[model samples]
Target: MSENQYAISEYHDADEINARLKELVGQPLHPIRRDKMEEYLRYFDTKCSRSKAMTDEAKTIIPGGVQHNLAFNYPFPLAVRKVEGAYMWDEDDNKYIDFLQAGGPTVLGSNYPPVRDKVLELVRECGPVTGLFHEFELKLAQKVQEHMPGIEMFRMLGSGTESVMAAIRAARTFTGKKKVIKVGGAYHGWSDQMVYGLHIPGTRTFEAKGIPGSASRHTQEFYPNDLGQLHRRLIANRLRGGTAAVIVEPLGPESGTRPVPFDFNQQVRELCDRFGALLIFDEVVTGFRVGMGGAQGYFGVTPDLTIFGKCITGGYPMAGGVGGRKEVMQRFAPGIGGTGERAYIGGTLSANPMSCAAGYYAIEEMERTNAAILAGRAGDRLTRGLKEIIERLGLPFVAYNQGSIVHLETGAVMLLDVRNPVKLLKELKPRKHMMEEMGAAYMSQGVVTLAGSRIYTSMADTDEIIDEALNRFETVLSSVEGIA
Candidate 1:
């Protein structure tokens, strides 16, 4: 198959799009009673007062009071003023031991002196961006290739979404196939095609607004742990022609959404091979943060293509690219009018010098200090401590990790009553709310977390910080239990 032969066909039908929208928007109201909504709102107001005020100010300018949807909560999101080694101070002059770390970018901690120095030095020399090429991009690409051997070739983008968009485009072009399959509940990015089944159960359509249904008509989604479901979908798609690629987070459910069973990823890899479809690992969150080589390296299951972001730039704006077998990547060569035909994958700021410098320095520091190994050890310590404390309190929670990505899930809430969607959504919402509340409480006490998600450890997260966080977690759990 050639790239030019597999061009995408347009299907624009306003009536069909409108009808689908009506069907989705006309779904019945949430089953929760007024009392439940009132309770949740009250709790949100009480615990997130500072966030609320900031959100109120933000609403005037930014939509939904935040630029990114994930940045918004029920009340609002806090505005961070400044960040240091392992801490952040909010606009309200409150300090927190920040674990959010800019959604997995700051693997080395906020404002590390080494990275900052490198960035400053580069900026002083030739400024931030130039239309022409720079040496920093080559240095960063070499660093990434050193760690992830699967990347025989590389490109760069502004965010994970752009990289993923290009990967899907390239896969379809390479395979001469139209359809793509993704794991349900796993978020690859916000691009139109990859947005299907995001936040499933309640919203099975597009996750965010403005993403047309026709744009995702060729995409299919299947649950993470169900190989049978995957097999069925692949078979169905193959009967119609064949799927181009099956992109997924190797550690499913968006990395931290759930602990991936050891066999799940291996099974998916096997299925992709069986179906003759390329398997892509969207390692946006797990890349370089989980280990030196990301999830594929940790799991020992190589994918045809891998997408990276976040930690690649060390909390900077630079994201990453699509990398795969030379044969597949060669489809983008200039001899074939590659830039125009193969996959229109270009960005003005792609692989710019400033971001390249940040990424190169960050990865070098991680290698120099063996940051991933140390982070894994720190994760083990924190999880063990939390498990012991939760057991003593008889709290319904479990703490686990995949390398440095530490997570705690409420066993009592997540395991209760899985039969009804309404009940399940209701239960999950409160549990999520409580988790956020606990995070806020921890912040008030000078310990910050990744806001109910997994925590990314840094070399700066010393033993004292870990011990203090555990102690505060115990205290916060007791308080929450009393309130309940």
Candidate 2:
């Protein structure tokens, strides 16, 4: 499982990377034909009847008829029965290409045989959790720190939000400062403090409902790719209290939905050094997927602390964590007797045998098969074909990919100013509906994408799979063109 044995390809070249980025042309979002969309909605009702019945039953228990926000799709949520490499069969036994990949984990593919078998065997033997330490925990840590050298010390959490909460605490404790800066739109997690400015950069308190103002008073937001604004914010924080950390999703918000300059992260690292602030890269999505070492390694900009999510356990449940160098990370060390500043974070399920075993083998599998590189190639082919499709249709819909993390921006509704009721009320619903319809359109034609607007390609998506997906994608476009 040595990383050196399998050579990972470079993610992107600067010139070509910008071209792909620029080619994400659609912004205000061309609305899909209304007549065609209504037809698709009618078709969904009949086609997904079983899903509707199951969702109705689940709604009686679960608040939204689904446990997670991701499950909420057009028409109704799909209750899946089976998952394999690049494909899923829902409750009604409808087959579709699974581009969602469980929200970007399972880079090797959904329910990968090797990792799943090992996990199942371990569960049968030692059990899921024994409420005590296990060997797999140490092995998982060793595997992670082996590839990501920045992680001299590591700790696990039940979810990515917990890791973010832990990272914020550690940064403040280590630096003895209160203020934290984050790039707007770059989601770290749903933790209260980190929700100050979300969905759009510089949108302070717009979506911070149910969260008190005091919760985020110390947490400020700055525009991505704008080092000058960050400099100003850092300077402002220094007057009352120094900035403890600057948190960011290295790929920009929504995984490059708002793309950053290639050198943006490096410059942020330099600024953090100058300002005595800790640099925290929330690689919850990008970690292990961008490369064996994550986005930091790909861009050659190391952060003081890193957060991980889906890639941690390769789509297994209870997968998330934080890691950092010895000096800063040791703040989480137990047995300190509450004398020193420690970020109290741990979940009953965190680092259990099941998650640890799954992660150990999952990372091993990724390295063994050159999964990152292969997935990146699949993403390249997928995005390329999408661009050609858009051109052929003469549509302005935007499509781009950063390695395996892909985005198809049918509507950048997040960019709309919710402040203006007139414009917001007029524009939001249709654009949002466009996104949902696009997603439903893709699902009907045998593909399942993330949020109906984004995609996360996997190593399972080979050329043949990509070609199959492209055919389905063209059908989705045809729905917009009223081509039946």
Best by lDDT: 2
Q: List the residue pairs that clash in candidate 1.
A: 97-448
lDDT of each: 0.69, 0.83
All candidates' TM-scores?
Answer: 0.84, 0.93
lDDT of 2 by residue, 1-484 (tens): 2333222233334345434444433244565677767776776687788899989999999998998888898878898999999999998889999999999988899999999999999999999999889999999999989988888888887888999999989998899999999987777778889887787656788778999999999998886567899999999889978999999888887787777767888999999999999999988888999888888887778899999889899999898899987888888886536655777776778889999999999999998998888888898889889989987887766677787888776666665553455666687677787778788888888799988878888889889999999998987786565233
User: Which candidate wins on TM-score?
Assistant: 2
Local error of candidate 1 at 93, Å?
3.0
In TM-score terms, candidate 2 sits at 0.93
Give candidate 2 misplaced runs (Cα > 4 Å): 1-29, 417-425, 481-484
Give each prediction's root-mean-square deviation over alpha carbons. 9.8, 2.9
